[model samples]
Structure formats: C-alpha cells, structure tokens
Target: MPSLPSAASAADMNQVEYLGLCDRTAVEWETLRNYEMFSLSPDGSFPMMKASRSKAVRLADREVMMVGGGRCFRVSLSNHPTQNKLQS
Candidate 1:
C-alpha cells in the first residue's frame, strides 16, 4: 500500500512553490522606471518597487534591498512584519 502524505508537508510545498513563482515573475517583469525599479508577482499578488535612481534586489516576498545615491536602503512590502523598520 502507498503511504499517506502529511498535511504539513503539503502546506510547506505550496508555500515554496508560491515563492518560486514570485521569484520567476520578478525576473520576468523586472523593469526600470525613472531610474526606479518595479516588478509584479506571477500570480499578481503584489508589487515590488525600488527607489528612483537606485538598484534593488528582492530578498523575499516582503523584503527588498536597495542602493542609490551612495546609500543603502532596505525596503519592505506593505503589511510585512518589518515594514515599520527603516532597515532590515
């Protein structure tokens, strides 16, 4: 007989897959606007924005690393836990 799958494992897998989709979307839709950067998640769940005249890197679903004007900035997606913080 085949073994049953665990609910926790399934949930974890879903999260991983979702994140991967987001990553891929970021790579696909990545663009520069007025020296700023922007991208949309594959599923259109959210949008990531980078400051103008700056470089940005997505650290996760809710985190972004940016650099510009000789300074580094850490940006967070709205409603994220670290949204209140200026830095990561």
Candidate 2:
C-alpha cells in the first residue's frame, strides 16, 4: 500500500486520487489494522476538528457538521466513512 503523502508530495495528486488514497488509508487503519483501539473516543461521541477557525456541531446521525473557510460539510463517525460529493 502506498504511504500517505506529505503536504508537498500531495500537491502532485489530483483531487480524485488524493481522496482515494484517504479512503484506502481509512480502511487499512480501521478495518485491517484495528487502530481504533488507540482512539480517545471510540464511540465518536466527541469528534475532533483540526481545521483552524472552524465550528462543528454533532448531528443526531453521528455525523459532524463543520463550517469553515466559508464552506459547510458533514463528516461521518464511522469506520468506513463515505466521501461527500465535491462541489465545483
């Protein structure tokens, strides 16, 4: 499996390939490696946001609604989260 790309290296990847890499990595870590054992919140009751100046609200369906950089998006609290449709 290809290693996760660094910020500089990731610039060479197109959006689709980058997102694909992220999906594969998540599957490897969550399903194959069982890395969730190291998670601070396994149930995802408290989701973390790394985005600067972002606001997040936990939804009823175990998804987080984030607003940052003039964009709003939802992220799933699941092992194999699906990618959101990209807006042009």
Candidate 3:
C-alpha cells in the first residue's frame, strides 16, 4: 500500500495542481469561488470545468480524487459552515 502525503506536501501539491488547472481552463485562480466545480482526472492531465447548480445538499455529498505532480489528494465537498475554507 502507498503512504498518504503529509499535510504540507498535500497542500503544496494541491496548490500547484489548482494553478495548472486554472491555466488550462483560462480561469483566474484568484477569482475562483468555493462553489466552482472542476472535473479533474485521476492523473490530473485533463481538467474540465463543470457546471454546478446552487444545490448545497447535493454538492456536499460529492468527493473527488485528484492526482497531479506525482501526488494524490482526496477532495471533499461540504456545505457545513465550518468546513468552508479559502485555499490560497
């Protein structure tokens, strides 16, 4: 079995992958909102912007695994007030 990445490494990888995805999709990273949906591949080679509605309950139950820069991350969507975090 593979070991999970440390929190710092995971965050770093997430930032890098997020930036790459933004560039590929012509999205401004600084302008991304919490509600935006991105369809990321397991290898993070092809990232597509997904259309999301305003249904918080439905969105909260979805989880995605994104891999990039030789790192893998489990991203969970949540509608809980405390779970919302601004990633910078």
Candidate 4:
C-alpha cells in the first residue's frame, strides 16, 4: 500500500492506493478532569489517583480486575479545551 503524506505536504494530492498522510502535524492525545477531582469521598461518584505522590490501591492477588467508571483531575497541558490535570 502507498504511504500517508507528510503533515507538511498538502493532503489534496491524489494517490493511487493510499493518501499521503505525511507532512501533516501530528495530533496529540490529551487527558482531562472529572467530577471526582472535587470530592475525594470514596463515594464521590468517581475514583481518582495520584501516580507521582499517591499510592495505588492494593488488590487481591489473582483476583478479578475491578470494573467501574473512574475520574480524575489533571492540569491541562496542551491548547486543548477538554484536557485538565488535578493539582495536589
């Protein structure tokens, strides 16, 4: 298959198989904050964690993984509007 065009080059170029996805500026991934940031009560409707200073909750060995909705607040890094970060 043909390769994608660079972010720099115009995507208007016609390709045989695949469009050149190169030359284009790469989109970045972003994180955001949730309601859990405000309330730390184990029942704030959202769970949170601090990877740098906070410790992760211990789980049972060989136990099934916990499945539920979770949330957190993180400082927004990029110009994105949705991304955010929880300040400790």
lDDT by candidate, in order shown:
0.40, 0.31, 0.34, 0.28
Stronger candidate by lDDT (1 vs 4): 1
In the range 7-79, model 3's lDDT, one tens digit per residue, is 6765566542122222233333233344554333343343332233222112334444332222222233444
User: Which wins on lDDT, candidate 2 or candidate 3?
Assistant: 3
Model 4, TM vs. native: 0.15
- The positional error of residue 28 in candidate 2, measured at the CA in angstroms, is 12
The 10-residue segment with the lowest total lDDT in model 3: 67-76
Candidate ranking (lDDT, best to worst): 1, 3, 2, 4
Top-TM-score candidate index: 1
Residue 56's lDDT within candidate 1 is 51
Question: By lDDT, who's the top model here?
Answer: 1
For the record, the alpha-carbon RMSD of candidate 3 to the native fold, in angstroms, is 15.9
Per-model clash counts, in order, read: 0, 0, 0, 20
What local lDDT does model 2 show for residue 18? 19
Stretches of candidate 3 off by over 4 Å are: 1-18, 21-37, 54-88
Off by over 4 Å in 1: 1-30, 35-37, 53-64, 67-88
In candidate 2, what are the lDDT values of residues 1-88, reduced to their tens digit? 9999666686776773212111211222222221121112433333333322343333233444444333111224344435463433
Can you write out model 4's per-residue Cα lDDT over 1-88, one digit (the tens) per residue?
9998666565856653211112122211122222211112323322232222223221223222232434332221233233233331
Name model 4 segments beyond 4 Å from true.
1-39, 54-88
Compared with the true structure, model 1 gives a TM-score of 0.23
